[model samples]
Target: MSLATSPATAATETRETQRWAYPALLALMALAIGISASPAPLYGLYADEWHFAPITTTVVFSAYAVAALVSVLVVGSISDRFGRRRVLLTAVATLIAGLVVFMTAGGVAALLVARVLHGFAVGAIVVAGSAALLDLRPAEGAATGKRTGVAFNIGITIAVVGTAVDAQYGPSPLVAPYAALAVLTALGLVAVILMRETHRDGRAVALHIARPRVPASIAADFSFSALGVMASWSVLGVFLSLVPGIASRAAGTDNLVFGGGVVAVMAAFAGVSQLLAVRVPAKRAAITGDFGTAAALLITVAAVDAGGRWEIVAAAAILGFFFGLAFGSSLRHLGQVVPAAHRGEVMSAFYVLAYLAMAVPTVLAGWAATTWSADSVFTPFMVAVALACLLAGGLGLRVPRLTPDAVPAH
Candidate 1:
């Protein structure tokens, strides 16, 4: 016998590793996303410690998100050249370094650096993890690898709540959570080590990062639906970036847990709504989400003015529910309109526009906060959100009702 190992034995070993690979990727993905969100609560802490203006806070918040956004654009296809396992291992190690920076950050500059590092790591982690999951899809199919972003939502929720608690009550509030997460991310590194490389011949594959663009045939439809998509998606972005400060101001308390809880409420309800959204008709969901989000945003503006914390929570639920309704349907609507040959380019454009659209009101709010009163930023920000949602609602009314098959898997 050659006796290197029995063929049957080797097969069993591969099967065993592959079996573990799925959950490993799932855990690592969740952890990576969770790390991206952990800083939401801590941003408030950073402001208090550094006495930075609201503009600085907004800049701090945007640093990571924008970095991740650009990184996704730049490296979204990098794994096609380098292989999934190699990219994944680099991402996790980078995540660890980012956490270490967060632990030791002493000023605004360090925080920004840490956030950008974390953002790049997350971008790489998401893209690479997504590809890795496809590589190891088991013979028995359950949900597809991404699972409709349930994992992403859950990760955001858990991280917000847990890091909030750590910041609120831990002896080493700033250090402890990041320290804990660093350990968890290190486990993710180990998971990547266990995973077999999917793209062994990746070196021969072409790598080209295309700029975002849609064919003219699809541009008008994309523009209209994108109104709904961008408006609805902006709610989540606004909450993640500015809501903690808004919540603290609305509640007249700086309780880290309370502010973070508002975000948790949005994430949890949004997650549940994802499961429920499919049951509703696509047109109805889009209509309700578009108009409902506008109304809720207007109400949220009032709640902030009236200093109503619980009202903010209610608005979170309403906004989240409606967001769940509109955003997914809008993507499906956009997807159906695009030609298969150009779907990738169109979707990339869709994402880029959505990200930039979200930044508009947020960046303005941050700048306005510095120039005017802290609460003054809320007026323009909420008004902007409401107006965008209203625009979407009007356009969405004209969209043709999609057949059941028109809705893409999220």
Candidate 2:
């Protein structure tokens, strides 16, 4: 068939090639999220087996966040010049190795190594995958935008849910979750092998490795968004580190299912809030959500002090609702401010702030837990986070609204 006469055939071939790529990318993202959370449910098991204290557990978790922050800072934009597929493949391989380490974990050393490796894998995958999604934007009439948003949200939600389900029901708390993640990482590796590469070749190599240059236009905007990310992730870190223990003690719920459920509830709510942000103005959502979250945190602290499981659960649910809103709005704003070319680098920087918030606060809180009652430790944390929310919300209101044309260059 003549090439010009066979346009339909050529188009069909092109689409068939691209068909598996997007879905595979989404799957890889989901797998990364699952691996990140899998350790949470197993911490209790590791604590018993390794005879580690709460501070040690927090250190293990914090190590991952620290590694992730470092990776994002060092190589966040490398995928922009080197193909996204290559970067993502390496990420999957690293994750599989991390899982292996976790499976063989006999001491704190193995756990720390596993956590750091997983952190690197997550950092690389998030930067590469998000860039790939932007590259794969569809024709104007297609449902690409909505699909991208949904895929991102779903990937995160699945991770949260899978961590809870696997940890709760799996055969061995320590070994099973990591093993399952290894399987998932293998699947992701295969998917990447079969997919078409999306990023362009031969762009300036200097551009790939350079530190993110935040444009003046977007710096202020990104600052606000980054603050929100920091606050939200800090809360996430605290919940991951302490909530399980709190639930076991206050709620008398020692089951992995219950622990994971509380964590998953917050994540699921965040997913829902992201979808809702499609309809609401970003600033409005931020203000409302932040205030609500602040209030919820205060109530949660009070309830924990009261020493009742039901009250804590109620408070957690309330906290989850507002956190969902805050996370969604912040992410939406992030999508808006950074242009496509510099997205990976900007996002890397953004997450640097986020993981820092996630890691440092937990470490401090862990120290506080050792020196004081859990309730005493949480009271100050709650007050500080509430104040952060109020400041972010107030600043968001004061800033002029961003329009399509006014969007900042990263």
Candidate 3:
């Protein structure tokens, strides 16, 4: 007779399997996003080889950003219809294809195409990967899903370092980074294959591109949650885009590595802070994060004025810590409030706003900086971020800590 396991045993085994899948999913997200940034350090090399103008460089980068936004609009909720594993597997394949195209690209047009592929993959991964994270760890989706931000920030940090190193010292600068990322992502695909399908809804639904819909269940909470997120993510966009230059300016030296280190330090601190955020209630953490973000920005500006290198480090730590608090907690708030069946679409909506806040205001700041002096622009930008954070904090104060019936808070 064949051996058989009881239902209790199977359920226990399933839980055990999910415990392991969580980390694999986190690693998968990190690597997928990390691969997208591999081209950053090599942009100069590509420009030289392909004879592209500066404007073309912006166009190429914008192609990725726009495709990412479009992908979120289209495939962002695809996982809700299909299983998360299937959508994620397809996304991983797209990621590998993107890297392959990027490695082989000989001109701007090919590069643009590669970027669009990469962009779509990144957006899809966030949509499906995030829902998978929530499904795999049902009770702690807020705290667990918050790790996605940690993974995302750390992934970019790793990519910046890895790409820079390979481009500087590897035998084949253009090919090595993409090759490494492709291999790792292939491994991630394997991990995704091994993961149990979390979405058990076998109901057939017509497949098509979708706009993100916020379910009525959590609509009241989403506004404040989004405000905090926008405030925090804007910090990321600004620091990533301009802090290296800020570092050079403050230090009165052109040590490019030093500037990169400042940004890296901030991201590192943010991840750590998010990891620590589990101890606090979500509402309190998010409100505190909002206030902390405002204060951190002021502190960073003060440190810049002081012209102390170590001061910048302290400032980065403070800024990142607070940004993490706000971002992680706000997302956690949503995770606690959203219905299980609608998790995919709701997260897609949240990320759509996040992507917008991360990119649009920063673009506006850059435009303003170009027209005026960079020095003058900082003041108003700082004030604006502070005001936004204050508004989020005010809204957060009105809503008590939320918990869904499906997944009650700890």
lDDT minimum window of 10 residues, candidate 3: 401-410
Which wins on TM-score, candidate 2 or candidate 3? Answer: 2
Ranking by lDDT: 3, 1, 2
Residue range 310-347, candidate 3, lDDT tens digits: 99889988988989899988887777787777766777
Give the TM-scores of the predictions, in the order they appear: 0.89, 0.86, 0.79
Candidate with the larger lDDT of 2 and 3: 3
Q: Which has the higher TM-score value, candidate number 1 or candidate number 2?
A: 1
Compose the digit string of candidate 2's lDDT tens values, residues 313-378.
677777877887786676666667677687666766777688899999988888887687454677
**Which predicted model would earn the best TM-score?**
1
Query: Per-model C-alpha lDDT, please?
Result: 0.75, 0.72, 0.75
What are the C-alpha RMSDs, in order, of all predicted structures?
Answer: 3.7, 3.9, 4.5
Best prediction by lDDT? 3
Tell me the spans in candidate 3 whose CA falls farther than 4 Å from its real position.
1-21, 37-65, 80-82, 101-112, 133-143, 168-176, 190-201, 208-220, 252-256, 338-346, 372-379, 398-410
- Which residue pairs in candidate 1 collide? none
